[model samples]
Target: MTRLPPVRVARAATTVRTAVQGLTRRMVPPPVGVLELVSGLIEANTVYAVAKLGVADALARGPRAAADVAAELGTNPDATYRLMRAAAGYGLLHQDGDRFDLTALGRPLRSDAPDSMRAVVLMIGDPRYQSVWARLPESVTTGTAQAEAVHGVSMWELLDRDADYAATFNEAMTRLTALDWPTVAAAYDFTPFRRIVDVGGGHGRLLASMLGAAPAAEGVLFEQESLLPAAEELLREAGVLSRCRLVGGSFHDRVPDDGDLYVMRRVVHDLDDEQALALLTTVRRDMPAGATLLLLESIVPPGSGPDFAKTLDLDMLLFAGGRERTEQEYAALLDRAGLGMTRVVPTISTISLVEVRPAA
Candidate 1:
């Protein structure tokens, strides 16, 4: 009824226009972010090509044209180019003239490259893991591990009993351990302790790194009986076997309580609350009066902010029935074990060190 001011009317119109623009933006697709979705699909699909063709391992010989690679591997040249082109588009590899050269990612895909992604290619491309990913939508709806549902037995149990899978599974862990070493060695200091015990130290790569970093420090590598031999060889090569002890036993059964520093890296997250509590409890019982316990893991950040480790959490849910934890979650677990949480050291962007000493 009352006459409106011209300035106010114009301002309101401007506000409405700006709001519509924002709404339009929200509805419109983003350019760079969408690239990741496309890339993820491409990587998952092409993982088969490299894993089956042994392209990653073969690349160590040197880059070759799609024609030559297809000939050596006995595949259609055009098909191989399509596959390689997909990878090249994602910066996994590059096509220089006719030859495909290793990018930063391609280098790691090589078997010779330390902590390479070759095992990743194998594991992700393998049927057991692959089938589960196909059932991801089912998991999303039901909130359960599709792997367990499809395969019947648990992922761990299946890997344990299957001879072929066991070897590949162990090798994959060893490879991941190798990938983690450079960042860990650069960031963590192992000099404070003379005797260090690595629980569930697969292939002893972590222990080797620790011992290498602290030449004066002796190490004990603990794992299942079958894994001990492999650990022994790894430690032997690192020249720490003289000082290293291989304890082929379970942490649930008993831990070697001889060391001042007891460490477990990426081990606890592969368990549910009950098993995690039990494992931590075992460590607590075996820990010396003044021993230091170092839990190497990723301390999940609060909220939905981007986190590399969070993806691994879903992986734990899918394959391992385990989980990634927030810092609060880690504290809760430590509390249950009758241990106190001390300082947590951020190792690399994707990992951290939870330093827990004896609770006074």
Candidate 2:
């Protein structure tokens, strides 16, 4: 039996989903379709509610009546049933009579699940964060982040002040990195590089994975000082602490030099063009002539078809005052920084390894 690559499977699934959406739009009245689009928030909030309420975790043991679950959770039975019914409608739960069970789709909502997404759901659906999205119109009109408008602080500042939120955000990043890093590590050959610097590496998961793959390579995990302890713990857990150096600093200020391979994963999409250029220029200045830089990012594809990057771009705009870029946009940016993009290596996940080097 032959197994298909995850990237190919993902693309096929996307194609099927697009076709289904298009067919539904063509069959439904325009007004009805638009109403469905506008009312998406209802479903989103429903999912958030169930995830927040521990409904998924409660159902993990076995199927149970909503009233029984509600009694355990100290909520109203009827409301719990209604919520569970809505979740069933969304295919996250299954209902038989009055009993509800967690579906495979909802399994990740459990904090103990192998690929848990509970933190991600809570982080995005938190009322404070959702309020920032409410100011999207203002963000679009002013072309700036709405975090300060909503929370009276920049996103980074808010994270610094709110320890719980910061922890959740870090956990979410770790979860995402867990899903993407193995594929990213396999997508490129790291064995040639003796020193690998992961700029803004969060919690050191990605860097740890690369180090495991490239036993010959020592790693530099550069991140804010506050994140160093967590990164150090993760590196130690991965058994790569001896092979890694945990550096505390801001990439905006400086990055470690002379590394043969430098990686910045999901970092550039969080900055505006000017800030991104400055950071890239710093890297270019520090990079040795023969060294390589790999930016692991979701390259926004051309055309009107659906891509998560398109939706993520809007989230970046409203939350961080940044935007996702296309291949051409990245190439131009690299050229301005005295670097040149050599190739884009696709990974099993949506992200790609964009290879670059100091310009000749």
Candidate 3:
């Protein structure tokens, strides 16, 4: 038997302890699991409250007294103190005396962070989105958008009318896309293609990633006119502006038929089957033989086990009049639109790349 050094023995012991703790956690069931489910709403709303109050943003520099944070944010000191306490309990912040500081998990909440989730937090907590979620029960009962029932308009219509809300929504989408694009860019091979068209590509971030990954490929960004400035700025920042063309158009009427590859990320899930089919048909009409269509969206898995898509399906139901689809459903939808599903490529992110080509 060989004797180990004291430090090495202690490190091995610590590793074993960690492994045992992990296994134990996996083996143990939560006490009153139903209560855990019921209390999730409390945690979610508390997180939202802290996010909206900009508490994390206020503490970006260093730990601050809760009252000072509240004063800076124009919020009530007592309420802010309580909010910070709750956030600290949730491990989003650490409390010391009367000061609160962000923990590792909470640092991403700061707006200055590269991959900040602040936009996501704000967008989800906004009254416009929350109003739709509140009517989710009605959506479940009627198989239609709860927003339509409550606000007498679709989310798109609401966005069109409310510029501020629309900007927030776009920022949220950009933040999410930024997080997911690196995975998609790495998982797919875009080198063979010369031209890539991104339909409904907001800010052109994903397209920029694609273009960056495939140096030889030029890009055509097609989106609403209002998004042009932002997309141009992103493309320029990526140094791919000279290689890309920005085109403002509606996919409902027509799409550019020249590209060898077309990408629509997180777009199809905003419509019902009829509308989705219509948009697909428009693209199919212009899709030359051997061209590819890449849908970058969540593919709902077969069974239920804490899947993000399952939850997003509900959000689609209440707000966008859409639903996440299984692999078979995507195939069938593609077939109907005269496109063939070649393969579904899984990425490091939750979203998958559903690759399709014009039906022979």
- Deviation in Å, model 1, residue 270 alpha carbon: 1.0
Against the reference, the lDDT scores of all candidates come to 0.79, 0.90, 0.86
Worst lDDT run of 10 residues, candidate 2, spans 1-10
Candidate 3 residue spans exceeding 4 A from truth: 1-32
The root-mean-square deviation over C-alpha atoms between each candidate and the true structure, in angstroms, is 11.2, 1.8, 6.8
TM-score of 1: 0.85
Q: Would you list the rank order by lDDT, best first?
A: 2, 3, 1
Candidate 2: regions farther than 4 A off: 1-9
TM-score to true structure, per model: 0.85, 0.96, 0.89
Model 3: per-residue lDDT, tens digit, 1-360?
133234345446656876775666566476645566677878878888877778889999999999999899999899899999999999999999899999988888888887699889889877777778888778888888888777778788888888898888888888898888766765689999999999999989889989988999999999999899999998999899999999998999888889999999999988888899999999999867778999998989785345678999999998888989999999999899988999998765678999989887
Q: Residue by residue across 1-360, what tens digits does model 1's lDDT show?
A: 223334345446656876775666567578844675566766776866676676666567778897888888788889888888877877777888668877887787776785477776777778777787777677668766766787888886787778787777778877777776666665668998999999989889889989988999989888889888878888888788998888888888789988999999898998888899999888999988888999888778776644667888888778777889999898988898889888877654367789897666
Q: How close is candidate 3 to the true structure, as a TM-score?
A: 0.89
Model 3: pairs clashing at backbone N, Cα or C within 3 Å: none
- State which candidate has the highest TM-score: 2
